[model samples]
Target: MTNEMDNQLAGVGGAEPAGAPSRQEDRPAEIAPTAPEPDTASSERGKSSPEQHAEDAARTNDAYSRSFPSLSEGDVVQGVVVHIDREGVLVDVGTKSEGIIRRSELSRDTSIPAEEIVSVGEKIDVYVMEAENQDGNLILSKKRADFEKAWERVQEAKEHNRTITAMVTDRVKGGLVVDLGIRGFVPASHVGTGSMKNNLERYVGQSIPLKVIEVDKERRKVVLSNKLALEEDKAHRKAETVASLVPGQTRRGVVRRLTNYGAFVDLGGIDGLLHISEMSWTRINHPSEVLKEGQEIEVVILKLDLDAGRVSLSLRENQPDPWASVADRYHVGDLVTGVVSRLVPFGAFVRLEGGIEGIIPSSELSTKKGTKSGYGIAVDSEVEAKVVDVRPEERRLVLSLKQARREEEQRRERKDVEAYQTQSGGDELRYTIGDAFRAQQQSEEGTDQEEE
Candidate 1:
């Protein structure tokens, strides 16, 4: 860059503008007065010969060459911002004239204001667009310099496989556009983990990390991938999550999918198996009954096979065991009500609260006369029974339906006996004629109802 600057300076120093006459052609015209009343002093000064005027012009040009440094086009040089305005910016590139950076040259993005890109008195690097324009003004550009530097940076990153972050600017037909100080294109196939075909507008204005996959400076083309970066990050997190997992630890996860036997839970980065057997304390025929896709749940780590990258989780492990407190809740001779769950040849199983099932032997199904075998025990029927025994450690419970019925009958008989004693006033067997007549009338009414 320095050599180029020197070469341009050598060509222009002590020289006049190309095809511009050296005071000889302009002297005659200058001596001719523009106004009728030409000043006498100006005419006397114009009386000098063309040769003398040309010598003075050469001296002046030489002085200017010695005073100002030369600036060449295509050279990126350090500059200090001297002034800024809506129209353009003035930058001092160590030249006689402050270089003008047009609004267009400031940045490719037209929406950004000049004040935001560079402030007064701020030092920046600018690319020389022209040493001097037709208006004798030096032209500079900041965007061109940035573009060159950005390409170099992007190329280096691609070589080293480094990650970079840039803001998504817009959505194109085949991909997304990002401003990496240079235009960076992210193909649709590389937008994320999978080929994203929808909702791409949501990424506009978002800052996303990317990896430079291809770079071509000659054609000014750069290709990037957001999917590769995401996949890499996910794999890294999966490894860490797997290494940190341990049995019995609880974790929060989302149910991703449901299978016949189990559900797949996403534990942040990795997926773990949640078998149906561990979904609840009670039996379940399918995983859908216990979990739904996309539902969030808490589960305990049941096991891990790190070598195979497999994990097993349990939902019921986090729940309290129903049998744990059964002994404290149900005592001997206590009456409990439940629905008949299953009927078998030996007994009927009743589903108690908290998924506890208590069994009643067939002999205790009922004590009512004329009740046939298995007549009183039907699946899904509500029933009341007395708890005869409880073994929490062994998870066994015994219930008898006959005992509950017998107690109810005794309560009714005691009430009747008390009524008779109260009427007799002495526990003596006695009945008045009116009471006998009333009893006969009640028996006749019951017989009449049966005959009808």
Candidate 2:
């Protein structure tokens, strides 16, 4: 009989293969309730082995003391998994009674597999909701353990300003859903300056950095943002870049955005305006035609307003100036041929040999005409012009089509006389009165026919 009692006691401890048992066998076989001994002194006299009974009672009391405290409604404790069934996992939390954490309480989510979260020997923290119900089993919670762990991680990340990387699991209004074991929010603005598109779907399987902007443990709410981190880095880099910038310096930049007035160029951490006026020497009606997004170009810094944090850039300054050599290439009184390009009320614009325009006033429009319709010039017609005035400083030129022809005729006649004199002496070139009259009459006849 003594051996039988010892075996039952041995089974109570380490009964679960060298581990704590799922539950305590406290009742053992109940002793018959013989009406209390007729008297204490009589009981004592009847006890033949008083010392042995005293030791057994002492051991039983110690075992009960070592068992888990009677769990209250909100006691938290650690436990080891001794058995797992389809319904739930049974854990030995030092309580004589096993804690029955339903599968639903095992995880905040009902769909999570119990085996994946715990194993036969793995130790886990649990919360006690009931030490022993009428059914005599302790009610425990595994989800609370997981939540406590998450909260610790969140607090650590916040203190160190560390980034938490998480995968996008869902899409909700104004933001995305991220799984940090707990659902977290990543606002749309926190994606990237409000320009990130397809972010929710594209980041579904990808992990991205997040800043824990807000956390509410009781409410189990977490908010995260990636844009804040990105903007902070950009601001730091921009300040460094702006400090190093100077006027008149040239750098390579990308056209980031274009507007009607100008284009915004990305000069690393800074943005510069490449105004439409500075795009070219000629007129530019719009910035798009002159600048394209993502185009890499060399630009000169016209002005750097550090206080205002603005940079002015110019692209046309790098091109050669056409007016730089105007004076050296052309001269006053020089006979030049040009095409009539434009006509105005005051004068006609003539294009010279090298894509330059000169003005020929109405008074200078006449050719060798003797009648009222003598000047019959048409638009786009080519004409010989004399450079009467050249104002290279102002990039202006005054031309005379009529004066050029007269100068050419005088030069031809003078050349003929000089040739005759050199060959046969000047005496043979003299003309008499009748000879002059005959030449004048012939000239008149040719003029009349030309006019007709």
lDDT of 2 by residue, 1-452 (tens): 99989988887563375554434343444653457547877776777797968877899988876774766776778899998888999999876667888898898668878988789988998877777778877888888766666787887887888778888887788888888867788888788565756456666667877888998878888989878766776788798888778788888999999998999998887899999989875445688877799999999999988788789999988866566777987899888888887777777888877666888887777644433322456667988899999887887889987687557655665675567668875455564567546654565455446645
The estimated TM-scores of all candidates read 0.59, 0.43
Worst 10 residues of 2 by lDDT: 367-376
Off by over 4 Å in 2: 1-157, 162-172, 177-184, 189-191, 194-210, 216-221, 325-452
Residue 289 shift from truth in candidate 1, angstroms: 7.3
Q: Where's the lowest-lDDT run of ten residues in candidate 1?
A: 443-452
* Whole-model lDDT per candidate: 0.85, 0.78
Q: Name every residue pair that clashes in candidate 1.
A: none
Clashes of each: 0, 1
- Per-residue CA lDDT of model 1 for 1-452, tens digit only, reads 99999988886566678898775566697576575787887876877888878988999989988897777889999899999988799999888879999999998887899988899999998999999899999999998999878987899999999889999999999889999998899998888765555577889999998999989888889999998888777788787787788899999999998999899998877999998889998766688877899999999998888778788999998888999999889999999999988888778888988888998987876664334445645788898999998998988899998788667656655676578878878565776667656664564455335433
